[model samples]
Target chain A: MLREVVVLGVGMHRFGKFPETSLRELAGEAGRRALKDAGVLPRQIQAAYFANALAGLLTGQESIRGQVALREVGVAGVPIVNVENACAGGATAFHQAVLAVGSGSCDVALAVGAEKMFVGDTGRTIQALAASADVELTHDMGLQFTAIYAMRIQKRLASGALTLRHLAEVTVKSHRHGCLNPYAQHQKEVTAEEVLASRPIAGPITLLMCSSVSDGAAAAVVCSAEAARGAPQPLVRVLASELRSGAFRSGAGEELSTAARTVRAAYEQAGVGPEEIDLVECHDATAPGELLYYEDLGFCKPGEAGRLLDEGATTIGGRIPFNPSGGLTSRGHPVGATGLAQIAEAVWQLRGQAGPRQVQGARVALTQNSGGWLEGDSAAGAAHLFAV
Target chain B: MTQGVFRSSTDGEGAPSLAGSRCRYCARVSFPARPICPWCGREDTEPVAVGRRGTIQASAVVYHAPIGFTAPYIVALVELAEGPVVFCPITGCLPDENAVPPGTPVELVVAPARAGGAPVFQFRPLGG
Candidate 1:
């Protein structure tokens, strides 16, 4: 019989700029914490997956990044697979770990995502971001991601489906929630006017509306159901984990965003409707992104996202708590580590371990993350569902 | 970045046009040329000159630019007359209308890139 996998532990090293720390150090700290939380020693892990983006470019640590980082936590001589799936790197690593345990290849597995960003020149950092797009096609054209998102926003605006006030409200809500998350990069709450008044990164996209270039790490420990017998912690099952690449041509046509396709597969796999999800942590790389995802993820109907926001349906104490960990807008976007951070938050909410941001009686949750760009769509996307 | 992707020479009493690839089997169009047909996964594709005129599907101005690029420049997604969409900077616009709204019509032009950079393919408002 096939075995089930459960996340036995989750850990994070906060989300903020840390020029003093190295990637290995950041990863090591998160790994050790996860091991402690799971009550498992280094020797118990049969295999591991390490997720990191730009380690080679920014930190000069290419190849064997897992071996270098894991060795710091006294883990060695195991099959350590390195994963880089753009912004979905961390969750992809966790997905592989779940597969490892579910396939009975290993009883216990580890997944860690770490990065050290914002320590170099601003222009170089910006260039690294452009690498997410097509280098030969879009990057050389000098396209900025904020500009890319702005194009979508402009289209929506032209259709009268959304407004600038709705965009500002998204950031305002994120900041208010981020203030309660200890690991968030931007913890201070800001008014909607402040978000609009911030320096513009692109048309209609202010600096505050964009996710910060943060440095941090997040780790997870997973084990087979048999191996987790009598484990001294609340068992949270991995109900579903789905990964899909952006379509050059989707059945629904290329006009639909990639996240729309990825989320549908996840929901079908989990057999859970959007209404059943008690909480959610989605890839809000920009504030406008979150509003659009509400429709794409089926949280609302098309062109009704602004109405949902106005109704306070997405706030922490509302009909559904979205991004209780502040999301990328406020929690910080450490690219490689962002996905696992969402996973960690999901696990915490399920285990009732979340302190201030805890959703009352939360039973089911989802995390939708995507990154990279090509041909005007996300290059990769992934979504996972968790339940207690 | 390569200098330009469009041909400078004329084609049979026709105006100069952009170089793109079209799948012979599936009739799918790709900008800047693709070796394989992305739709049918076939290698049989032909080089074709795409029309120079396109409509602006969307537009935005970047205040934060990459290394060696100027800020607050316009970039628009233009749907070519041949049904291929390309991203190009829109030129010859009034300084105030940096972010062109969707549905504006534009035509192709080759110009020196920002700050004396490489020559890049650009789009200007139709009849502007």
Candidate 2:
């Protein structure tokens, strides 16, 4: 049997433009905060797993990023493994650290994700990120992720599965919550009229519907449940942590299966279901991504996401609060740090620490993150269930 | 008879795409570009240029574009003269209407893109 693992502490650097902080420094700051929150010193960390994407291509620093980042905080001689799973890099690192602790390979482990991407020119940076898709198909077609996902939206809408208003509602709702989130990159509340008036980036998705690129870092401390007594008050438990790779039928059109499988695995591990989830933080790189995740995670049936949005089933005070921290749509997607931030958000909700956006009496929370494209679908996915 | 094929590069001697086959065992058409007969998936597959003219299978207008991308572009999936189908963007056409309608005729042209700071191949419309 696997040892039980619990998240002792979590910390996230503010999720916005931070041109003055280097990636290493950003990671160091988050790491230090996580250690402090866990009441553990830097030297007490047995090992560190770092998650970063685009550092090699965008930042000119590739090799040993984990070593450089961790050493900056005066923590050294521990195994520092660098993880690069595109946007899911952070969650993947967290999963690894969970494994390290659950498998009894380490007592105290650090899972930190950091990225510095806001310094570059817009066109170049976007082009580089688009390269993460199916190059052979996307390169010549000029189809970036936004365009590809937009195609899915078009197909769904054309099939009478969704409407433009449904898309607008999600944006409006996210913005409403985002306005209450001080750390959100976008805090202004917008109406559906304003969202509809935004510049279109793809068939149905507008520029305002996409996530902003930002620099940030997030860190988590994982240890056996026995190590949790000394942690801060109101402890939150890591009920389950799971990762699922690309499904064999990914490009065959039913790509949601990957995320579904990951969530299912997490549910099985946590001994719970979507009905028990009071809060969730999902990968909302685009407005539609969040909508689709609702169905994929079993919160609703396929194509019913639009209805869910209109009903406000995902709002902060709704049946299940989703993305209470504003999500990537407004919180900024710092790639590597995004996954960890999702976990942090879940922990905050579970511990009743999410101030204005808190889901009252939230006890069970879920996080779903997918990254990279394989065979025209999500290449990597991770899901976790947390409780208090 | 005159023959044609698609090259990986704009220049000759790049990579040749072949069509049809006359296997020593039995004559048949093998779609994959082969040095030897593809009937056996062996060294006998031959190299040939199947030419450019093709039938459009499907088409869509990309109303939303990626950053650094031209908006309102026409993209299509086409069955080549050789029979192999390819997906490409139909450039130089009206955002509203284009000969790129499904089952319409189309040809290939070279285009530019960014790859590791270098320009790469992108497909464009063939004719007006």
Candidate 3:
């Protein structure tokens, strides 16, 4: 039988543009912090997984990414694995680390995600992000990821399922949450009018509603429950971890989205429902994405996500607080580092260590992350459930 | 302007049609024609023309363009007559609410994807 795994420690380098910092410096800081938090020596790490999505395209760093970065923090001679799954790269790395410990392959494993997008050219960064899609089919269309979200939001607006005001309100909420997060890139709260008036990037999607180009890193340490019996940090159990890829569907069929399917599998594995989830850190690359995930994650009935948000059920201290860490829109999306940052947020909240943004009495937390785009859906989706 | 994605009229007098693949096993159609059927995992598939005429399912006006693209251009997802939905640019209109809203009938045409760029398949409102 597989052994139970627990998160021993987590850390994050502040999420924002860091022109003066190198990718190795960003990753080294987070890794060192995690090791220190776990009170474990660097030599104790049995395996390592490093996640970086755009390094090859932006910085020209191809292979041995994990080994190269981890070595700066004194991690070496171990099975260092490099992971790249677009934006979900961090979660994929964490999943592998958990599996390593749970399957008895090792007692301790490390996961780190880092990205450097501020290469002095905005056009180059945009081009690299667009490569996450099926380039062959979409390269010529001048596709921007924001436009994909805009298309979805436009359909919902056309159907009257959502309104322009609701979109603005969500952005306002994200910014407000970001204000409480020290690591957030856009910490200043925005008003609904401000959000609406911000420069429009796509149909009904203003600049404030989208995640900005950012550079940062996040790291986590996982060990078998037995290994964590006497650990210093509060224990956070890994109840479930699920990853899934998009399935091709023709027409407007009634198939569940990739996010929905992945979360359903996680729920079944954890033997818990959405009602048990006290807090969440979902992939809100755009403001409307959070609203859509409310339904996709089974938090509410179809066509009622907007109503759920209106009820204030997703704000801090609400019934099911979401993105207490400001989500991608405000907390910053460093592509590869985003998923691990979600993990760091969830762990802090579960331990009651989250200061101002803490979801009071939070016992169970869930994180949902997705990456890339394919055939009208995310190419990969990952969901993990944790409890204290 | 990827090669083999679409076919132009031999006489150069008609609109281009997207080249897709139809599975001989499950009859699933995929745009940008796959060598093997995504559904049924069968290699028995044949090239077919698609998206000659379609209805706009969703659309957006992109104000922040990527490299080689101008800002404030319209992009859309159109459901073809054959069943596959293709993402392409929508031309012959301004970026506004009335710019080819969902459900508007459209037809495919070959146009420059960017200023002075190679021709790629795009969509335009029927009779616009």
Candidate 4:
């Protein structure tokens, strides 16, 4: 009943502190690159979804963000929709684009995510990031996202499910991958001693183990299968795309974590399981997050994520590689831009175009991007499966 | 303190009691008191006081603070005896020391959120 959707092209601007770059410029560059890669003009795009989380709070560009940014890249005269879902905005936009094409509404759609966090004021950016949580209850609580992750890690550490060594090791791996990624913000590899000795942000999390505030943009072009008949690039099918919101979880209940629930739905939609995944681009905002998601994404059972890391299973050459683009910790988390950046990485690897970080023989790739925090879970969780 | 989050003690000498609502239809309880139950979308709910004593489920000493907050403060998620978790600052504990470990019993108290700021509810290690 529904048409098949495929990703035609993807593009990204490097992630780092680009104080001289404007939001429009950042978005326009990525959008233009995606169009060029797809061999399509801006006018060919029937609908556009622009994702930016902090522009309203950080840059004061409240409404019509999509229209304003896309117009600079000759993306006018199209129905542009703005999306904001904290860190998962880009994936949300992509999900909408896929739906648009699959529902027979449009043949070509575009999703773009961009953020400029180096606004010459660090305090304001931190303040805006904190607004992603329940402001009513946590405004006065001095809530930092690092602290939330630190708390979770502390509990696991106490239970002996993880160790300080595991945290440092995963960070080392992230940086090692980042060193091969030209777009990564922190490409220099770090030693375990250096990671442990670095400045502590919260609990056991060090400065090197966390993602930095970055400025960047990423974009993707989606089209119906018929539109991709003779495309220059290899066909990349959208096997599944799912987006879910956090439900009320009391922590004591048996309710699965939001990521688990979302990924399960994606697996069902795709008619596949974790064993079929060749590589993954998980939302590892912090070092330990990658280990936790090994279990959350069903790659391993509980209490065995550290073992998966210990076995070097998540490295580029290992089974089920993760964060081949250095992930958020090193790729730089420009918030809204992170999701699309992951998509771009997946597309590259699937097309055998990834220069140094490609997972050999990679075919099926999954991306799990989460955003915000609500009721002790990510407010928005998205899992999209792509195959070549 | 945010309005409708807590109420003054009857004797007016102790910390204000945290408020919540219990649904009559589904019997689900929500903190900060909701007019309607979040579980079943039922408007039949009653305001009730949640327990002030709880155990620290997790705690972290934040070195980087956001605006209006000082660095090196302890923030924690405590599971109240009444079966709800609340996120608040842990008072009466040095940031550098692991004085209040997870599972440590704590009692709610009112303290200034920041220098010269209005008093808000926080937790302190029992008998510390």
The parts of candidate 1 lying over 4 Å away from their true place are A250-255, B2-5, B8-16, B95-99
The lowest-lDDT stretch of 10 consecutive residues in candidate 1 chain A is A248-257
Give the CAPRI rating of model 1: medium
Per-residue accuracy of model 4 over B1-128 as CA lDDT, tens digit each:
56767665643636667888889898877886888787799899998777488898889999878778888889988888877788888998787638779789998886677887666778989998
The C-alpha interface RMSD of every prediction is: 2.7, 7.4, 1.3, 1.7
Model 3 lDDT tens row, B1-128: 67888887753636688889999889888886988887789999998878889999899999989888888899988899888888889987777766888789998888787987777788899988
Q: What is the lDDT of residue B75 in candidate 4?
A: 90
What candidate 4 gets wrong by more than 4 Å, as runs, is B8-14
On DockQ, the candidate that comes out on top is 3
Query: So what's the TM-score on candidate 1?
Result: 0.95
Q: Over the stretch A157-195, how does candidate 1's per-residue lDDT look in tens digits?
A: 878999999999989999988999998999999888899
Off by over 4 Å in 3: B10-15
Error of 1 at B84 (Å): 2.2
User: Compared with the true structure, what per-residue lDDT tens digits does model 2 show for residues A181-249?
Assistant: 776788988888888899877667887788888889999988888877767756777888898888543
Candidate achieving higher DockQ, 2 or 3:
3
Model 3, A237: alpha-carbon shift in Å? 0.6
